[model samples]
Each structure stands twice: as structure tokens, then as C-alpha cells.
Target: MMRSIFSAIIFLVLTRVVYAIDPRWGQGCTYIDRTEQIYCFGGEPFSENSQQILVYALNITGNSVLDLSEPQWTDIPGDPNGIRPSAASRFTFTGFPGTDTFYIQGGIVCTSCNYNSGFKYSVSSNQWNQTNKNKPVVDASSALVNDILYSFGGQTSPLTGYDQSNTTYRNTVYYINAKTGADGPSVKPQNETQLPPFTWASSMVYSYVYRSLFIFGGKQLSATEVTASMSDITVVSPQTGVYSKWKNIRSTSGSLPPARWGHSTIIDSSNRTVVMFGGCNDSGKAMNDLWLFNLDDAVWSPQETTGTPPTPRCRHSVVVLGKYMLVLFGGNDGTFNSDINVALDMTTWKWTNAPTNILPSDSSPPIDFPNSSSPQGSEGINEGGDSSSNISGGAIAGIVIGSIVGEDSSSLCLRNETDI
Candidate 1:
């Protein structure tokens, strides 16, 4: 009986000692399979005006294979000679498969101020270089298919005269060569064919198997009023230098999630389905529900998950590691910024919080309130949609910086930016 109790205590201690560290929510993050590493960069941290790049090396299991471990966050230094992007939120990061390069584009630098320029980072070199000189309009939804990056439905706010009432939303679609950062010839909208309504903060994912880019809910704003949420799903296919006319998939069966913006969606290539979670509704309330859309059958179904879920939030990052696990980190739970990390198993639909001791020390100062709009919102637009035009401008000031929250005793070598 004594031996059983002792063994139980040991098991609990081991399980609790390796918790995943938390990052400031609203940053852009993506997993690079080539290095078995996850890179997160740029976002508003609490009370600070600058943002930094952060990296995490996933723990591996037996046989030299890549496996998920509680991620230990590390601060990656900026390149002295490289063009570092200003700290901001609502930017898009797309990883180019088979290469160590990822692209960042179209985020706001301040309330009502947006960046159209794009930059590329080489994981192997740990440096940043300007991509296409032709800036993409900010707040656009993008996806990387084949070697091309496609952007759709963003708004442009002028630097000087930026005002929420004067912002312009677009239905035009643009493409850029992912490898060379040059503009691909634009495809004109099909004649007499209507496109998806002008929207921003929509989520998009590209499925290689189906060769289609799927776009989900976003908000549409007009001079007179605001459409806080949209339910239409638009599909576009890119071929050679052209794109197919947008097709709206109207669900004939199963229930659709409430139309909301700032939710995160990821493609489960193994299961051939898209999973979505957490965003704010038209009422500006944060959500915690999980929803799944089957690409094969074109059906949307809510997923009932087991285990303690992260608090409801929006603007967080979610990435698929390997075939079945989804890693979700950061976001604001309406009132406070959240630094929680949680994962969902696709096969069994179970949620697991990465263990605890590996978490950053609570002694660190409390994070500052996020002062930027949803990377998709205009100067006065809330990160999550709110019907009232009475938006808070106080939270749209200073930039947020990311830092290593805890000590890492592991022997992993810190590579210099030049040596990357």
C-alpha cells in the first residue's frame, strides 16, 4: 500500500514538471517541420511598446523522431543589419514548405495605421529581408498554395487621414510568388460574377488534396453600419497564374458555428477536415467552443471535447504539429491577456494543457493590456467585433514585446542570428 502511494506521487510530480511556457497572445506563430522548431514573432506585450521574435524547440522522443513536448520558449535576438519589422499585431505569417523561409505581411503598426509591406525570415539564417516592394493591403486573409501566396478581402487605412468611418474594404484577390516575392499577374474578377462580400478578419486555409482555398467568417463594415459577423464560406482555386471565381458553400446539413471574427482555423490534412476555435461574436463576447468542417462532405459540426479547455479568447495562434495534435497559444479573454498553452488531439477530440513547472515564473511583471486593434480591425475597430462604434482607443497605443518567461536549464545551444 505504501509503495502504491509513493509511485502515484512520483507520477504526478513528473507530469507536472514540464509545463509549456506561455507567450504574449496576438503574436504570429508557425511550426517549421524541417527544424522541428516553432517560431513566434511580433505582437503587443503588456505595457511595452516593442515586440521581439521568440522561438521554441520541440522535445523529441525515441529513435531520433520528432515528437511533441512541453515547449520551452526562448528569446531570439534580432539581426543587427537586417530590416526588423515594427512591433504590431494582426499580421499574417505563412511558411514555405521545403524551405526554412516564412513570410510576414499586412499588420497594423498603430491604431488606424497599417503596413502593406511584406518581409521574409529565413529560419536557417535567422535574418529578415524585405519581400515584395508592392505592399499588400493590410488586414487581408492569405494562404500559401503550391509556390504562390494568395491574399483576399482586406481594407486599407491611410496613414494620415486614417479613420474607422473612412476605411475601405476590398473584394479584390491578389497573388504573389512565394519564392521570389514578385507580383503574380492579377486575375480579373469573372465578368458578371459577384464575389464574397467585402470582409476582414476572415480565416482561410489551403488544402493540397482538394486544391482549394477555403475562406470562413469575417466582418463587413459599411459607412452606415457594421455587419459584425458573416457565415458564408467562399472557395477559390489557384491554377498557374489565375484563380477560380469565388464559390460559396452553403451548408445543407449540420450546424454552423456562430458567425464571428478573429477565430483561428487549421487544416487537419490527415483527417481532411478544418478545425476552428475561439473568437468573439457580434456581441463582442469571447468564445471557447470548437467546430469542425469536413472538406470531403462540406459539413460543419461542433466538436465536444474532453479535459479542461483554455479560457475563451480571440486573436490567439493555433498550429498543427505532426498529423493529429493542434497547439493553441495566447489571446485575450475579453478582460485580461491570456498566456495559456493548450493542445487538442484530433483523433480522440481531447484537450490537454501542457504540463506546468516549465511555465515562466509568475514573478515576472504582469503583461500590459494589449493596445492594438485586431490585426484585422481599423484604428477604432476592436480586435474582436463589437457592434457599437464606440470603440476604445486607449488600448490602441504602444507596441507589445515578447520575452522568455522562465529559465531553461536544457543544454540546447543558442544559435547566433548569423549562424542560423
Candidate 2:
């Protein structure tokens, strides 16, 4: 009897220890150079099935995703009222010089949300602060650009539930200063910018690859009513002043992503290709077709991706880490905690056969820093033709040079999953 009791106690202790060290995907991951870490936010529950552990990586260097090592969960709670928000949305994690952390912009605390609200997270302190502004009620569209957060569409009232096929839109753009010091003076949102009533077709399906944010395709922006007549790419550059102008990239191609708002997009950095998968059609019909966008050329080319893209999903959480773009865990797709992480390898153009839960050791070649020198003392390209300003090393790391002049693909994946 004494031996059995001792053995049982040992097993229980081991189990608890392993649970504490489980590899948490977190809501999603971000870079925390100030902390000398890579931080990942937890995915939110649009419903009960959407909850997951939020995590952070402390020992990262260079551009290798492997730098994140494995993720460890932070001791944070998802209670909507909790100071450390586990769930997140359109919040921008902008880092500044002299500090090794990123500031969370505006986002909704949807741990138990029926709609949306305002909240922010701090990486250094692992804290979330309730903002002064209660966001304008909009169900589907919101994004963070620069120091401001913007919500584009969705109706606040007469809505008790969420419908991925929702087309009702507020088309109002709300902005907030995200860089305000944590304990510094109070900040105010600039004037609200409103646009024409839009269809919320893209809300359910979209990705944030590239930079300066762009929406590839979607229906009318309003809910309560749905429209499938429009399918054009709309872009909003945070750099634009006053009101960020929405530029329409009209497409003449007969091929588009089938008027979607909930499908997700992933940037294949290795190939400069945009992969979009799963969303309902304009008429409340769920779809599972996969599409690819050539951001370099501003063109959408459809691809027949294999190995089971989740069955007709919308409102799913996808993230880019290492060389694999992991697509797993989302709802309105028959089940949640689907417990599957699909790894798509860009170099091989094939999916790997492994438990999504089990990923290989992360790896990526370091940037060729020494090769960074300009051609033997010759100044690089100038504004006119004279000696140009020297481009700093940090500038080179974030620089995207190619045919793509649009959103950050990784940002698109996070934005779509931002409500998490």
C-alpha cells in the first residue's frame, strides 16, 4: 500500500510538470526585441471553442523563426475584465527605439464577446489596459495602422449573434493613438472618418500579408443585407495623412477569390505568393476553394492546394512561424480545437505528413549582413542621381523588395484572427 501511494504521487507530479511546459501556440506570435524575445498573443474565442493559451519566446536572434525556440505560456487570464487580455484583435504591436518591446494598439477583448470592444496589451509588463474610448460597434472589420487603430464596417445594434456571411457595414473609420505611454497622459482619438456603406463580405475572409494593409475581395460591407455584386481589391496605407485614402485596385481578371470575406491569406515569402483559403460565398454559402495572389504584380491567381484545407472555414486563426505557415484551430467549420496544424512548405510546394501538434526544430539561414555593403564604396541608388542617403541596416531587414506593393501577408493572417 505504501509503494502504490508513492508511485501515484509521483505520477501526479510528473503530469502537472509536463502540463506546465506544454508548447503553447499562444493567440499568435510577435517580436519583442526589447525583452530580447518573440511574443505570441493568444487566439480568442469568437465562441467557446476559440480559446487557446497565449505564449512568448525569450531567446531569439537574427531572422530565423527558430530564434523563437519553443513557446512558453505566460500566466495570463482571458476574463474580459482581466488586466492581462488573453484574446486580441486588430491591435498593432509597434516597437520603438531604445526599448525592446511593442505597444498593443486598439483591440477587442473577445474571451466572451458577443460583438467587439476596446482594449490594449503591453509586452514588457504582460498587461492589458482598458482604453478611454469605447469603440464604435462594428462586428467584422477593424485594423491597426501606425499609432492608430481603425474599424471600417459592421452594425452594433440589432445583432446578438455573428454570421460569417454578414454584409451589413458601418463603413466608419475610427482611429486611436496606440503609442501613448502606458502611464503617460491620456490620448484622444482623431475625428471619425466615414465611408460609403460597404458590404462586409471581406470581413469573414481576408489576410494581412504585405504592408500598408489591403483587402483582396469581398461583398458589400453592410450586414442585415448582403450583396455579391462587387469584387475589387481595396487598400488603405497607414502612411496616408488625415484620412487614409482607400484606393481601389480594379481587377479585369475573370478569376477572383469568389466574392469572399472570411477566407484567410498567408504570404509565401519564399515565393512572394499569397495563399487564400476557405470562406463562404456571397450568398451565405460556405466555400473551401483555395486561391493565390501574386502581390508583386497585384494579381490574384487561383491555386489548387491539397492535403485538406479545413472544410469551408471562416473566422479562423492562422500564423506564420519558421518556414511553415500553420493553419489550424478555427470554428464554424464543424468542430473547434480541431487539434490540427497544417504545415505548408513554400520551397517544396507540398504539405508535410506529421501531426500538426508536432513541428520540427525551427531553422532559417541568417541574413547576409557582411554582403550588405554597397558596391565597393559606391553609394546606393539616390533620390535624383547624386549620392543617396545611406540605408540603415535595420531598414534593410524590414525592407520588402519585389513586385508586391501591398499589405504584409503575416499581418493579414493576424488581422483576420485579431479578434482572438
Candidate 3:
């Protein structure tokens, strides 16, 4: 099955050259429209000094990969601050139905708490504005349940190193209400709530079966040379409707992913399973193996896919693209985050490397959400049918710069610049 999948991918890339993806894109956020279109928003994958939102269209009508365009750009309205926060780490935006706005959560904030500043982009007007939802600005290891966002284990507001052990922010789990209108839930979840024990680098996700937030592996310190392994389970129910209390998501022993951080956890509705991959281990080991938990049977099973899933790597971004294929982007390999793109065909359990885009040294967007200054790519993500690029990194002494994945992430960060 794996061989067949690999062959199919190779054949498609070779024979069907018409669908090839351009390499000049560098990198940006993604908004995939099933088999029709893939809208890539701006970000910094190049020099970190730029910011502008660029949109690329992957038309699947006549072919697969389509034309790239520089449509209307939103300048983030005003001068929010210095170099845009790297979109690195964890990023997932929830769109409220009735409203034309969506909530962008915890991600790289200029290596500082800058990313802690959430903004709302109007899809209809193509405008950007600041949002009030700015608090626990940690990323890379949080989860979602119901509408409320469950933030646990991951890098804290990089300011004072880790926020754990802090009286106000101890081993805590925060639940952000997803209400978009008035007359919502009364007793809301606050940041003051703490947990029995805390962890960073752990993967948090939503479990439909349990109707709560499910958390996976994580470490003790957010940015440490050493890490404490955790088999401990932690779950947080929303304070709103049908929200459950904090319970151990589940605690199982035996060989797991091997104490690591930067791993990605995805909810696979097609297979009714939760998937995890890639994260540096205790001994600075990165993982490339794929594991799945059967939601129906409550089993933690590592998938024995056929083709070579990328070599054991950590910090790679993975998201459910097609029904069975999960799209994985550049991630850390114990050395640095790569710029390669690959797809995992869940049905056949195979790894398919996608086309690579090469960007010109001079051809850069005003806002780069992907690649940035330090030759360090921060992060990027898809939101509201629009792609947002942010660069996040702990480069500055007191700042965690946003390092985006693609080559041009900074272009998206320069929203207010008259020169982006």
C-alpha cells in the first residue's frame, strides 16, 4: 500500500507536471478549499523585516497547482509594533458562524508577548483590527474543546521564561468561551485555574466522543535543555455549556513517543482517530513516526505505515488536508526547521513529498509571515479561508520572534507599512 501511494505521488508529480507548485512562494499561511482551491495568505518565509498579506491561488479546475496572484492586501490597519511576531509554534483560528470575524489564538509573538495580541480580520471588508482576546499567549501545545479554547503545556509568554510555578499561572488550564453574541454562558473559565501538575510541549486536542479537550505528551520546562517525560493525562472541560471538569484525558504506560516536544496532534474525523507526529525527545531526539489513538475503542496505536514518513523530525506542522492525507510542513530536525512539504496518505499509510517552491532573494512581499531575518523560519497557519503568516523565535534576549515556515513570512507582518 505504501509503495503504491509513493508511486502514485511520483507519477502525479512527474507525468502531471501541469499541477506542479511554484517554488518562488517561499512560504505563507494556507486555506485549502477541498479539491477546488488552496488560498495561501501572506507571511515571512524570507527576510524578517517585511510584512504584507499575499494570496496565492491553487486552482484545481484544469490542474492541481494553479496560478499565484497578489490580490488585495490588508495592512493590519495601524502600526501595532516592531517586527511582527513569528507565526511559529501552535496556531489555529476558530471562525464564528454568524459573524464575519474569527479568533486567532496563541502563536509566536515577536519572541515576546506581542503575539499575545490577538487581532480580528474582517473577511468581507478585507480589513484587520486589534482584538480583546489577548491573555495566555502560549503556543505549539494547546487544544480545543466545544467552542472554548483549552490552553495547556507549551511555551508560555516568553517574557519570564516559563509561567508555571507562578502563583497566578501554575499548572493551569484556561478555557476561552467561544460565544460570539450576548446572553452566552455566565460562569466563564479564567486563567486563575491551575492543574495538579503542569507540562510544556504537550499536544492538546478535542475529543468528540468525550466532548472535552484531550491532551497528550509534554515536558516540564518550556525552553530547557533537559525535559521531564509525562505519561500523566490531563483534561479540561469548558465552563460554558456541557463543559466537563478537569479529568485525566488518559494515562497509559509503555513506550510512547519518548519524552519530546514540538510534536503535532491532529484530529482525524475520517478515521475517527487522533494522530501525532514529530517532536524532539529527552536526548534531543526528533521523531518522524506516526501514532494514532482509536477514539471508538480507546486504543493508543502507533501506525505502521508503509512508505518512509519523513525521518524522525520534530516541530513539523501537520494538518488534515484530504479525507485521508495529512499535510505536513517544515519542522525541526534537531538541527533546524526544514522547508520541505510532504503529505501522508492515511489509507495507505505512506509519505508523499510535495513540490518545493523557490523564492528569489530580491522578490519579497512587504509582509513576510514565513522566513525572516535570522535565517530562522518562524511559523505560518491557515485561518478563515485565509492564510496568515507569522514569524516567531526566541532570538532577542527578551523577545520570542515569530519564525514562519515558508520563505516569505515577514511580508504578512508589515500590515501598516506604506512600503510593504
Which has the greatest TM-score? 1
The residue ranges of model 2 lying beyond 4 angstroms of the native Cα positions read 1-75, 78-117, 136-151, 158-168, 181-196, 201-212, 218-224, 227-230, 237-254, 266-273, 283-285, 295-298, 306-308, 333-339, 353-420
Cα lDDT tens digits, model 3, 1-420, are 563454344334322223333222112233322222223332223334434322233322222321222122112222345223233334434433224344454443333324434544433344455444444444434442333434543444444222333312224444344333111223333322333334555666653334345556666633443454434445444322222233222323345445666566665432135566666777666767676654344445667777546655554444333323333333443344332345565545666554212111123222211111211110111112112222121110000011112111111100010110
lDDT of 2: 0.37
Output the worst ten-in-a-row residue range by lDDT, candidate 2: 396-405
Task: Give the best candidate by lDDT.
Answer: 1
Candidate 3: which stretches are off by over 4 Å?
1-46, 50-102, 111-115, 122-125, 144-147, 153-155, 158-170, 177-194, 221-230, 239-254, 270-272, 295-298, 337-339, 354-420
Error at 200, model 1, angstroms: 0.5
Point out the higher-scoring one by TM-score: 1 or 3: 1
RMSD per model, one decimal: 15.8, 11.3, 15.5
Per-residue alpha-carbon lDDT of candidate 1 for residues 1-420, written as tens digits (9 for 90 to 100): 563454344333322322445445556666554454456665545334333333333432212323234444545555656676555566656765446677776666544333536788776566778876554355566665555666666665553123333555665456666567777654444421435567677777755444445677667654532433324566654432223333233344444678777777765422245667877677667788887766545556777889777778766666544322434454554453443556665545677654322211223222221122212211111223221211011111000110000111111111111100
lDDT of 2 at 233: 46
Candidate 1: residue 418 lDDT (0-100): 11
Clash counts for the predictions, in order: 13, 49, 83
Top-down TM-score ranking: 1, 3, 2
TM-score of each: 0.68, 0.54, 0.57
